[model samples]
Target chain A: EPEVTQTPSHQVTQMGQEVILRCVPISNHLYFYWYRQILGQKVEFLVSFYNNEISEKSEIFDDQFSVERPDGSNFTLKIRSTKLEDSAMYFCASRGDPSTNIREKLFFGSGTQLSVL
Target chain B: LAKTTQPISMDSYEGQEVNITCSHNNIATNDYITWYQQFPSQGPRFIIQGYKTKVTNEVASLFIPADRKSSTLSLPRVSLSDTAVYYCLVGGLIKAAGNKLTFGGGTRVLVKP
Candidate 1:
């Protein structure tokens, strides 16, 4: 089965530094998303991307956060300034066509562990 | 988005069946119940999804009653490797770009030998 792949499985950065997390969603998948989970907290949605534009974003996705689909295959999330609270596991997910009968399940990557000091 | 409630944790012995129930009293007409499993430090993996009635797949079975307010995820013959956090989410289809998923507090299942 094809899977989503994320680069730099672990990242360590100092406060105020910029960080970009990269993901390659399934080739045929259309909808892409970024979610984060603070240690011991529920997974929170960050943003969704489709048709090369952001479809939806949460309050957690503030000014410092941005997403890009620079290429047909790559989806990236960039944080301009990192804070200690930014430490969490960032996940990239994708889904196929969204037909009700198909129930397009979201496939997730193994996730990148972001550690901000 | 409908809020979901589930047990915080559960324990079972190897070879036993495990059923995790999730309650969503305010589920909408277009909402679907989806389940995801997550191991330590990993992203949530899709298990099964159902709108109503029972849906069965190779990995698990999802049972949704007529009311569609609650759903159950049944894992048959679980093993120690089955130990993971299972999340139940209620959301509509991603027809447009703006529809995002909301994950609830998952149920942590520990299968012992």
Candidate 2:
């Protein structure tokens, strides 16, 4: 089974520095998403990307966050400036188009553990 | 999407079946019930999803009554490796860009010996 792959499984960055989390979604998948989970907290949606544009985003996806599909398979989430609160497990997920009857199962990557100090 | 309410935790034995129920009284007509499992520090893995009636997959079964206001995830003959956090989510009909899965506080299942 094809799986989503995220780079830099663990990242440690200084506060106020910029960080970019990289993900390669399934090759044939069309829709992409980013979610985060603080330690001991529920997973929270960050943003969704389709057709090279953001389709939806949550309140937490503020000015500091941006997602880009720089290539066919790469979906990247960039945080302009990092904060302590931004430390969490960031996950990337993708699903085939609904018309495919794939049931839209979000294939999530193992996730990147982000830590800001 | 309807907010889901579920037990915070459950305890089960190694050879027993475990049923974790979730309530989504305000589930919309277009919404579906989906469950995911997560281990410590890893992303959630899709378990099962159902619209109505009973749907069973290789790993678990989802039972949704006619009312669709609630659903139960049944894990039969669980083992110690089955210990993890189980999340129940109610979301709009999943599409290319419309499926935003909101995970609530998951039910932590502790499978004991």
What is the Cα-based lDDT of residue A5 in candidate 1?
99
Say which candidate scores most in lDDT.
Answer: 1
Residues B7-112, candidate 1, lDDT per residue (tens digit)? 9999999999999999999999989899999999998988999999999999999999999999999999999999999999998766766467788889999999
Poorest stretch of ten by lDDT in candidate 2 chain A:
A96-105
Q: What is the DockQ of candidate 2?
A: 0.69
Write down the C-alpha DockQ for each prediction: 0.73, 0.69
Candidate 1: segments with Cα more than 4 A from true spot: none
Clashing pairs in 1: none
In model 1, chain B matches the true chain B with a TM-score of 0.97
Q: What is the lDDT of residue A43 in candidate 2?
A: 93
